[model samples]
Target: MIRLSMMMGRTAAWVACLVLGLGAAVQAGTVDVYSNNVGGDAVVGASPTVAIGSSGWYYSDVRVGGTAGIDSTFARSGNGSVLFQGDASAGSYKADVSYSTGESLGKLSDLSSFSYDWYRSAASTNNGIQAPSLRLLLGVDGVYKGALVFEPYYSLTTPGDVATDTWVHSNIFDPNMYLWSNKDLPFQEQFNHDIAFWKSEIGNYDILGVSSGIGSGWYGTSIAAVDNIHFGFGEGPGTTYNFEVGAVPEPASVVSFLIAGGFGLAGAAYRRRRAR
Candidate 1:
């Protein structure tokens, strides 16, 4: 019939363009940004693709000299960046129960947004700056417990302040989620604790942490810079692709859901041959 259905719709459009050109040369969720200036000093797992062995990051504070290296004089795009000395410590029991900017990023998957690129450097005295609230921390099944409690920017005025040309972007998932509370709004004005016990145990947490929680700590030696750090986003907005964050659709996101259901069933069989 009709030339055998136009040779079976051109052999299923050449097998969906050869499986979307081998799924764009086998690309799959891979993101890690320590600014790559090469973790020179700041010990404690001195990065190696960031996380594979040496515990990517950890520093609960009290001024252990608040460190974390690699910062070739500030970068917002690349080449180098991620120097967060912010010294200002206090650990007697809560000036920073300790958290030199906690990091572990292992098994990271689910993310629609987590951007980064915050630089503040009027040079020193900005100390171990953090207090503006910033905790994402998770570990679901592995159990580091969960947390969202946000706020990294509201800027009474100068967003990301200081200056190095102000590299502030920090999104961290829309309007800053939030789920740590005495009822919320920052559990009795700032962190009394009990955040609904990990937002009712949300799972699939492939380990991650990004604290600043339990405020009023560090803010003296100043100098922050972090860089282009990104996590997947987009299976929508102008679409590029995104799915990572397992517990389900693995296998290259099931070949991106069978290449988006074979182009949505070839656009519904070419609109049923223009409605006959």
Candidate 2:
């Protein structure tokens, strides 16, 4: 009887450890920066529009004309993703969307990493490889400092090019990953540089927010979507955003759900072990 009791205690402890381990595996760094389910359908642009979405996020079709909004037809995670469609047949158009983070996003030199998942529809007719560009809004002393841009066309890393109808994860912060600052310059003159180089060149810079979309020259009515954005600052775990359609559980609620599930699993494990 003593040996059986000891075995049961050990089993329970092991089960508890397993549950805790599972919880630890869940990404604590991830944050739902923008989880609202607004603008699920495409909004055709008659003229350039700004601040087109709820929250601080805004959509712009400044280049030519196209559509921009949250889309439900395809998503990398959850039930939706921000979609951009550039018009080509009529004229060159770009679909750009941006989010103005209410708070200062820290300095450029402190930015440790930036990544996002993007999808290019097979129907898109951009250069066989062009998808979308990740733009980081920059400022200094509360003054605008144009955007720091990263486009797959200039990337030297593997999976550096866009593949239509498939979601591709792009980590622009990787060393040697090419990027350019479009401040006071034309796209042709904005030469590509690595993150380290940009940091030095930009001097004192503050990250204003993040923007991603398709266009400028992505002609042929190309379509693309972006989601799962992450920005790491100064060696920290960083912030992550998972765009979703419709209401999502608050962070606390999600934590409670996970804890409850873990406890339930532990109970089941305990019972099975005792039955033995």
Candidate 3:
């Protein structure tokens, strides 16, 4: 009887460890957030086209000629990517897609990771390696605050530092590695101000949304695509917006899959214990 009780206690401890491990694993991995290709076709619109997901990502072209949409031709990984294109002929053309949903909004210090894959076409009439840029919009409610912008043109490497005609993966999570503009002044590009700086300066401001695209007098006839927008904030699991060309699994489907996997893992662990 004593030996059986000891074995039961050990098994309970092992099961507890397994459960904790599973929880950690779930929190660590990236879950699918949103997609561009919906209902087997590419969609584009001016000033707010919804990407298919519960996450509520939307594409917008603030200017008349600028446009943002799903492009099947220039994908970074999957069969599709979000494309931003505009000509300087239109006044300050700016096109972008943004996520203003709950998963994105939070205090500045709560951001743990932020990154995206961007592409610049060689055919871009822009003089240098012009590409789509990334932005973190800061504000509260519906009010407008300044944004933190990231552009590859600031790099001292090449015509733009980033290679054209191919996808460039950027890791902007580290404030030390990437330069960001406060966008307080027109075309005001500066660096070294990290998230901590923003927190100190504008303690009341919070992250309103995230955006990626090109234009606003960037150059003439620019073309770019963005994909795999991965980010984590507000104590939630990380999410990757895989802009793809096919049907993506629903959130419910993902949850069911995780639950099934957990059961399988637990069963395997139980069998191992029995063998022991």
Q: Which of the numbered candidates is closest to the native, going by highest lDDT?
A: 2
| lDDT tens per residue, model 2, 35-109 | 334546565666555553345667655454677777676776777777777777757777777777566678888
TM-score of 1: 0.26
Question: How much does each candidate deviate from the true structure in C-alpha RMSD?
Answer: 17.3, 7.5, 7.7
Error of 1 at 113 (Å): 32
Arranged by TM-score, best first: 2, 3, 1
Those runs of model 2 whose alpha carbons end farther than 4 Å from true positions after fitting are 1-27, 33-39, 46-55, 61-64, 157-161, 185-190, 248-276
Which residues of candidate 1, in runs, are more than 4 Å off? Answer: 1-75, 78-122, 126-220, 226-251, 254-258, 265-267
Question: For residue 110, what is the lDDT in candidate 3?
Answer: 77
Candidate 1 residues 19-127, lDDT tens each?
7765654354332223222343342222222331222333343234445554466644444544555444532112121122244444334344554456666655543
TM for every model, in the order presented, reads: 0.26, 0.71, 0.68
